[model samples]
Target chain A: EPEVTQTPSHQVTQMGQEVILRCVPISNHLYFYWYRQILGQKVEFLVSFYNNEISEKSEIFDDQFSVERPDGSNFTLKIRSTKLEDSAMYFCASSGGWSYNSPLHFGNGTRLTVT
Target chain B: TQLLEQSPQFLSIQEGENLTVYCNSSSVFSSLQWYRQEPGEGPVLLVTVVTGGEVKKLKRLTFQFGDARKDSSLHITAAQPGDTGLYLCAGASIQGAQKLVFGQGTRLTINP
Candidate 1:
């Protein structure tokens, strides 16, 4: 089955360093999103991208966080400065449309560890 | 802000047992979705319920959406070891932005 793919299954970075997580959503999907799950915590929404722009973002997606669709197939989330609290599993998801009925397809996720 | 509260954060049952997990919220939703996640992996979509009081069955698993669209439940009959996973429920507002508000999740362990 066609699925969303994320690169760098696991990453370890120093605090204050910049990190970029990459994702390739389903080819035909139009809406893309980034979500994070802290250890022992609920999955939290970060941002949503569509038409090369961000549609919505949460408080957790502050000044240090940004998303880009640099190419037709690649969507990336960059953190300007990593922190200890930034350690989490980041998941990329996509959907065909914006309707409530559209189901989200998610990638395996990238584990980010900041020390 | 919308929030989904799941009950019985953890459950452990033996093979051939029956169990039910619930998702509740005070805010009405346009749709509700259920997902299952294993250790160190992302969530996999199980089912999506759109209309109120809708019921869908997938083999031994049955899903029901409340008539008010603010709650849902998942019931598993004769659950096996394969049913062990973290189950999460999410809801989307009637405005239809496609943003999901997720519940804390229920960790179930089915021992064979």
Candidate 2:
């Protein structure tokens, strides 16, 4: 099966450092999303990207967060300055449908740790 | 804001047992999805329900969408140890290709 693939399965960075998590969504998928799960907490949405523009974002996706699709298959989430609270599992999802009825496929996620 | 509350946060049952996990929300959804997540891994999509009162079956797992589209349930019959995992329910509204709001999750253990 063609699954979403993420790089650096785990990341550890200094509190003030910047980090970029990468993902390669399925080739046929259109809409892409980024979500995070803090330990023992609900998976929270961070942002959504479609047609090369941001479709939606949550409050948690503040100035520190940014997403880009620099190429055909790559999607990335960059955090300007990592915070302790940023330590979580970051997941990337992709879907082929244009509507809510479409199912989203998720990657294994990158575990981020800020020291 | 949308929220999904899952009941029986943790469950431990023996093999061949039956169990039902619930996912509820106050806001109506255009679609709902169920996933099973293993420890230290991302959630794997099991099924997606689009219409109200829709039912989908996968092997021994059955999923039902609420009549109002605000809730859903997952029933497992004759569950095996392979069924042990964190089950999550998520919903999305119709306004846009908005982000999915996930439930806290139901941790189930099926011991053989």
Clashing residue pairs in candidate 2 (N, C-alpha, C atoms within 3 angstroms): none
lDDT of 1 by residue, B2-105 (tens): 99999879999999999999999999999999999988678899999989999999999999999999999999999999999999998988556768899999
**Most accurate candidate by lDDT:** 1
lDDT of 1: 0.94
Index of the highest-TM-score prediction? 1
In order, the Cα lDDT scores of the candidates are 0.94, 0.92
lDDT of 2 at A72: 89
Once fitted onto the true fold, the runs of candidate 1 whose alpha carbons sit more than 4 angstroms away are: none
TM per candidate comes to 0.97, 0.96
Model 2: per-residue lDDT, tens digit, A1-115?
8899998899999998999999999999989999999999999999989999998899999999999999888999999999999999999999897676566888999999999
What is each candidate's DockQ, to 2 decimals?
0.77, 0.70
Q: Would you list the clashing residue pairs of candidate 1?
A: none
- Note the chain A TM-score of all models in turn: 0.98, 0.97
Q: Which ranges in model 2 have alpha carbons more than 4 Å from their true place?
A: B95-98
